[model samples]
Structure formats: C-alpha cells, structure tokens
Target: MRENEPHRTGPVLIVIGGLPATGKSTVGRAVARRLGGSCLGIGTTRQSLYAFAEHGGDTDTLRHAVTHGLGYSVAYALVEDLLSQGQCVFAECVNSRKATRDAWAALARRTEARFHEVELLCPDPTEHDYWRTAGRALAEP
Candidate 1:
C-alpha cells in the first residue's frame, strides 16, 4: 500500500470464496499477503456483530435474517474506500450463492478495481469434515 508503487494506481480486489472449511480464509490471507494488502473476512465480521450484540434478538428477526447482508455492507464499504485510495484488498467469505458472488463482482466493477475470484474446493470428504468439525473446535476457545 505504499505510495510509490506502480500497482497502487491499479487497485485490485481479490475475493476468496467456497464451501465451509475449504481453506478460503487460509488462501485469502495468503493472497493478501502476497499482494501486500489487507484482508476482510465475513466470518470475522459476523463474529464481531455477535460480540457487539447486533445479531438476532427477540424484538426483530430482520437483523438475524440479514446477517450476511450486514457483513457484505461492511465489506463493500471497506472495499470502496480502500480501492478509492488505490490499495489492494482481499475479501474472504463462504459465498455459497451465485447472487453473493455476482454482488462482489459488481462491487469491483463499480469501484473500478481489478477483480480476481478464487474458489477453493476440497475433494476429500474426510479432510473437509475434519475442518468443518474438529478443526473449528481446536481453533476456538
């Protein structure tokens, strides 16, 4: 994100997405590191929402229903700001739906930043299940 680098003028948004426990976060972090940029993860954003008490409540289920939308809103705003400053960004999300994927691409188009889509897949059911269950438990308190 240095000012003197030529790539600064050409902002890029690399989106890493896939099914649960497919290594999307790992790949997104690696891609962001390689590009010398920052990473925005939806899971982390959602967790933050939970921590901040912005998630589901008895009064209204609308916020709960739009949890993903809330994450995307924050992510898109961050992307717009970062791209406007000519900086690269990496976004990590499950992105299980075509609409979600297309929305990200549209965000890139609007920001005038180069869009790179990376989808990770794990063919081995055992490994995928391990990460889906045990891996998460080990990583969390």
Candidate 2:
C-alpha cells in the first residue's frame, strides 16, 4: 500500500493560506505530492470563473457572486469526496479574510478530518516584491 493509503487511518486536510505571491500554492502542492494526495487550489477555480463567464455564462453581478462563492463551494465538495475515499487533500487559497479561513476549518470539523492551517509570509521585501512582480517565486525557502 502507498504511504498515504496506509496513513488513511483518518481523514487529513492541509489548508495553506496567505497573500498573493506568498507561495501558498507551492507549499500546498508540495505537501500533497509528498503524501501522494491531491492539491485543490481556490485560485485555479476562481480563474476558471472568467473562462466560464466569457462563454456567455452570466451577468457581471452574477459572476461576482459566483466567483465569491465558487471557490469555497468546490473546495468543500472536493474535500468531502476525497476524505470519503480515504485520500488526503491540500487546499491552497488566499484566506486573508477570517470568514473564509473559518469556513475551511468548519469543513474539516464537519468531515472529522485533522485540519492543519499554514499561513505563509515572505519576510524579505525584496523577495516578496520579486515574486509579486514576476508572478512566480525564484525558489521555495
């Protein structure tokens, strides 16, 4: 059996959150990969909203409401499905707002999963600026 499969003694959810360019995606992806699990990114889902909207989807008002709600909605569904299958999940999001973070925590509680929250920060302004400007990190620190 795989390491993750054996460790599936219980559900596990790793939630990574931070400001843009703070490497939340990188960390979440890495952790999930290391554990042979899944990485579900809110930003990816959020970006897809634009593509859907471009395809004659909805009005701006509806798009805005959907964008705000879709990430959490999809993430919660993924978490539930994966956990039910005894799979680990790492969720990456810009959970700067307390409500959003609390929602993730609540989902973990509802699923009876072990919830781990990781808030990333870049201490070096130079590095942070570089990542923000280039839209990528030079390396994971």
Candidate 3:
C-alpha cells in the first residue's frame, strides 16, 4: 500500500494451505500480485535458511531452527511486519499439521488482521499425480 493510498481493513493475512502439488504457490502468487501485496512460500523460506547456514550465518541457530518451526516463525514475523505497514500478504505452505494452521490464525488475531485460509485439493488423482511428477521434474537439475 502506498503512503497516500487508503485500505479499508488495514491488512489481510491470506494463508494458502494444501498437500504438495495442489497449486498453492500458483494461486498464492497470483492473488498476491492482484492484491499488490507480498507472497511467501515455506519452501522458499527453508531454502533461504539453508543458504544462510551454508554461508556460516546462524546467528540464532537458524539452521537448527529450520528443522523445527523456524520457517513458520519467520513467516509470522514477516507477515506481522507487512501488516503493520498496512500491506497484505499471501503465504503458501503445506500446512500438513493442524498446529501450523492454528498458529497462523493465532498470528492474524494477534495482529488484528483479517485472516483467510484456503486449502486447495485436487480431487482428480490423475491430475494430482501429474502435478506431483512435474513438480519433481522441475526441481531436478
């Protein structure tokens, strides 16, 4: 949001969750772009943590924290910062556990931001399998 712009609801926290290959990133990024906000992915955060660790900058043991719940923690902090600035955020992740989803909602409440959780599911197994395969192929060098 620009300094001169006005937002009706302050900021919004959009959490997109689903199993792998459910199109969370695609949807999240598209929505973020449309909303003129930021898009964040859990895998991207984890890779960042890994890269920093590889570069020998674990000031707070971030590498070890990544193995735990640091990615979500970092995401929370990032989202909170953006919300404080009146910018919406779209966060896509495999919230495979209920605890993770709950934590995201809790963060939204703590920040007094509107929270939306969208869980994508591919009911067609064939298409889902193709997405999974394509995702793996894309990951391969």
Each prediction's TM-score against the native? 0.83, 0.84, 0.84
lDDT of 2 by residue, 1-141 (tens): 854454556888888888888988888888788778899988787667656777774558657866678767877887788876767898888888888888888888888888888889999999998888787443323
Per-residue lDDT tens digits for candidate 3, residues 19-106, read 8899999899987887688899998888788778787665458777897988888888888888888778898999889899899888
Better of 1 and 3 by lDDT: 3
Q: Give the alpha carbon lDDT tens digit for every residue of 1-141 in model 1.
A: 577533555789888888878988888787677667888888887677656565446524545744748767777888779887878888888888888889888988988999988888999999899889976897689
Candidate 2, residue 74: CA error in Å?
Answer: 2.0
Off by over 4 Å in 3: 1-7, 56-64
Off by over 4 Å in 1: 1-9, 54-68
Task: Report lDDT per candidate.
Answer: 0.79, 0.80, 0.86
Misplaced by over 4 Å in model 2 are: 1-6, 136-141
How many times do residue backbones clash in model 2? Answer: 0
Q: For each predicted model, how many residue pairs clash, with residues at least 3 apart or on different chains?
A: 0, 0, 0
- Overlapping backbone residue pairs in candidate 1 total 0
Clashing pairs in 1: none
